[model samples]
Target: MDKALPRTIACVTAVLGLALALAGPAAATPGVPAPEASADGTLVSRTGTAVTVTAAVGLSNTISVWQAGDTIRVRDTGDTVTALGGCRPVSANEAVCPGAGSLTELVVHAGDQADDVTSFLESLGVTLVGGAGDDSLYGGGANDTLEGDEGADFLSGGGGNDTLTGSSGRDRLFGGPGNDSIEGRGGGDLINAGAGNDVVSGGNGNDQVIAGTGNDFVDGGPGQDTLDAVDEVGGNDYVRGGDESDTCRADLGDSVTECP
Candidate 1:
């Protein structure tokens, strides 16, 4: 019995040693490396240390490979770029962007050309300023201010209390919600006050103004114009036709008085 026990113990010890030897190399070896992640947009060109990213039209993208002292160029191809992060405009065509991971404030500036611009908002606020050329701007959620400085423009305030100004040329303006203020500074313009109580003025040219929903104050400034404020059910609106011979339609309990 003693001889049989010695044989059994030796056989068990030999098996354990073989198993440990077989498992040692695998336990000591390093794991396989993870696949590298690619940047968001198409890498159009890489010259020396500078990289140019051509984001798909109407789509916004971020490149993570940008390091300090690296020049990053973005090409939007006539589409408006809404920055979800920090971006400062160096020129009408270029900008200094924030880091890829920091998706913070939305900083947006219009491009050089006169083109249509669209913006959407989440919980964060947005600011959109137009360029020298004719631009069409849409403000989607936040309390936004849409300013059309130079040429003929179209500005729409989607939600929030917004300020829309058409500085020059023939323009179109629409106010979506909350309390809004709209001004068409020059050329013949069309203005619509969508939901809340609003103050609207057609600055120059032969303009048309429509006050939709809430109590509104509308002024047709200068040229021959048309004003309509009959849309609100329980709203009291004031329509003043300024300067030239103007035609105005008012809601029940509303007032229409010609300017001196």
Candidate 2:
């Protein structure tokens, strides 16, 4: 454990305050922070070195998690929904949000336990950051992001074109149904860029990368990794196996860089 870390992790993240629903596993290390769950709902906050984010669930039950500068905040309420993309919710479930969505960043601190997060509504880019456990994080709407801080984690970009980062451990990363980007920062990893044109990197481990169905860029970085261009359509993709001895598969009209 890094003593420099704030020493807190997220247990689970609610979907706009759905904390009562996705309660998964315990922290790999104790003393991590997670929102409390009760009939009345709960409010929780975690602070890191440079950022602080809060999570909440209220009686009215709508979650709001966003970042302001370096300070990120989350609040869930049954009585009121937070103004997202400059549109205030007149009702809990109903809001005439504009087509051009506006939320840029959201922050969540998951514990070292296995956890999950979800959001549905407008294309507000949400960011979910996981802790030390084998966590699972999901991104929603337009241009979202998910980061698995430690442990064997799973990250999926749900709808919009998004970015997924597997920070450590043997993690699984999936890009969305849109043009996406993914990174396997360390440890052995499995990466799949699901749809549209994508960019991927398998960093510092023996990884299995499947560039799915698009003109994509794949980099098997610093390990004996396998890079596969699983291009089903008539698409050309690029693959590069970095550092160690690697295996690469590509189709015609595709570019290969230092990969065999």
Model 1: residues >4 Å from true position, as ranges? Answer: 1-107, 232-235
Q: For each candidate, what TM-score against the reference?
A: 0.61, 0.63
Query: Looking at model 2, which ten-residue stretch has the lowest summed lDDT?
Result: 8-17
| Runs off by more than 4 Å, candidate 2 | 1-104, 232-235
Give Cα-based local distance difference scores for all models.
0.60, 0.60
Best by TM-score: 2
All candidates: CA RMSD in angstroms? 29.1, 15.1
Relative to the true structure, candidate 1 reaches a TM of 0.61
lDDT value for candidate 2? 0.60
